[model samples]
Target chain A: MSDSPIDDLIQTMGLMWSADGGPRIAGQILGYLLIEGEPRTLAQMCEALQISKGSASTNARLLEAKGVVRRVHPVGSRQDGFLAVPNPSHSLLKSVAKRLRVQADEISDISARFPDERADAQRRIADFAEFYRQSADFMDEWTARIGPARGETAQES
Target chain B: MSDSPIDDLIQTMGLMWSADGGPRIAGQILGYLLIEGEPRTLAQMCEALQISKGSASTNARLLEAKGVVRRVHPVGSRQDGFLAVPNPSHSLLKSVAKRLRVQADEISDISARFPDERADAQRRIADFAEFYRQSADFMDEWTARIGPARGETAQES
Candidate 1:
């Protein structure tokens, strides 16, 4: 309930996370975990984000499955808590790259159904997808070079 | 049509064009116009961009309306054709900024309806939208400084 910049930051992130890229809801949970700063209980997330508890739980679990955020139980609490890995910008980039790859693949498959008529379009799709793949790889390298924020220290993979 | 790299380039371009950060058929038309090296007839675009004649006509008009692309008649022919300006990367930055602006305005209007309890969440949305305005401006400046592609010159507005 405190006025924190992180609250704004969280919502901004949710806009991106909730971005369907076509039509999607994944963005909300990513945004919440992103600014929570530490692992938080489901109740905290639902209250803070003003989303239904079921929605919070579902999206939180989705983030964990994608390896963008993780589930970590606090020492004395029975309730499950979650934390996003430090340097989530890298996570964000990788997620985008992976999804783009899927899109590229789907486009390619669609092109395939059209026979030789689509050969050219198929090639273009594959080539551009390759561009995105390289772009994503380049981002991974670039972010790693920039390293973590001062004092936080980078966590080794 | 011949196997012009430009055609593959256009096909790839079409595939790569995004509206609001997601791909749109309008983008491909813009890409084709950007690189086809000359204004293309409605016939040429329909063939190259792989859209219907009506779709090409409709989208090209929309692009013209947006000031991103233009309609032109060939030197002496009666054919209707179009040309795309070589915009800088910052053009994308600016367009994205514009979309964020619209979202921000929507937040302001939407907040007026929330009586009390939901006021904070609406405020969060309004703040979130404001942040993108600053971000979009920053991106536009940064992109302008970066300049255009190596060999391709961009005409500054």
Candidate 2:
């Protein structure tokens, strides 16, 4: 643990993401941005998170593509800034639901190729496909109920 | 892709799993069992899946631990068999919900250590914690609504 609680928390985020099979430095950059609640340049992120400039830039862009971070141009600022998006989990959930739909489609495609002798197997595959498809729909509904996404005004439920 | 559609499907499964950062052999074993919908010995799995005994055994055990496959013993049979669990996605979803709960706890713990000057950061952390906690509960409810697990009789909805 570091002397600063903030650093300790950032390390925890890094470790947690690594445990989930993600890059540790990406999680660290996310943690730093989330806690700062402000736009930071690539150099600033590299300095504060103690990560290499290349690592910071790469991960920040990755996070931006994933919808958890944004690239911003502050007034009169020469360098671009990175800021953590509000409700980052929503985007992650969206990707997961998309994956489930893909799995469902793949399962259905495979099920169509099953031999006549494996009728039971086809039935089982059908059930699995249905489960994944339904799960994707459920996830989409759940995320919708979570309210607005980043930079959007809240709407009436 | 292989000439046999079944083999092609299994290869697809392996590729998908590897893409997701999981063991490819495990996904192949799962695809084999899932298509057969019957228990087979490790030796049989190795021979049929064209995998080594070590890879087949280890990946089968790994799939078993993940609740996607189970070890079974046919009556009067000396050797054990591994069968794909019905509705395996339910267990995977359960594990995901459990992980969300862990994340919520970690975020809450870290939020407590933030200094007074970072009240806005604390609020954002609280929002994230709330999101994770609610998501865990939502996943649990959804999975519970998915009907029976492995070997259980279907109940009237």
The TM-scores, one per candidate, come to 0.53, 0.89
lDDT of each: 0.56, 0.81
Interface RMSD of each: 9.2, 2.0
Candidate 1 lDDT, B1-157, residue by residue in tens: 7444445445554555562354466777865665454678888988876779888888887676555665676678999878764442334445555665665565455444544665555554455455445445544554465554333322324
- Tell me the interface RMSD of model 1, in angstroms: 9.2
Model 1 regions more than 4 Å off: A1-23, A30-72, A77-80, A83-157, B1-7, B18-24, B65-67, B104-130, B143-157
Candidates, DockQ: 0.11, 0.55
Q: Which digits, one per residue and each the tens of the lDDT, describe model 2 over residues B23-137?
A: 9988888878888888989999888887899998899877777677778889999988988888776777777788889998998888888999988988887787788899999
Among these predictions, the greatest DockQ belongs to 2
Stretches of model 2 off by over 4 angstroms after superposition: A1-3, A152-157, B152-157
DockQ of 1: 0.11
Displacement of residue A45 (Cα, Å) in model 2 is: 1.6
Residue pairs in candidate 2 whose N, alpha carbon or C atoms collide under 3 angstroms = none
Worst 10 residues of 1 chain A by lDDT: A148-157
lDDT of 1 by residue, A1-157 (tens): 6444445445545565445342133565555554444678889877877878887878876766555676787888899988765544444444555655555564444444544654644454454445445444544554465453222322323
lDDT for B63 in candidate 1 is: 71
**B87: Cα error in model 1, Å:** 3.1
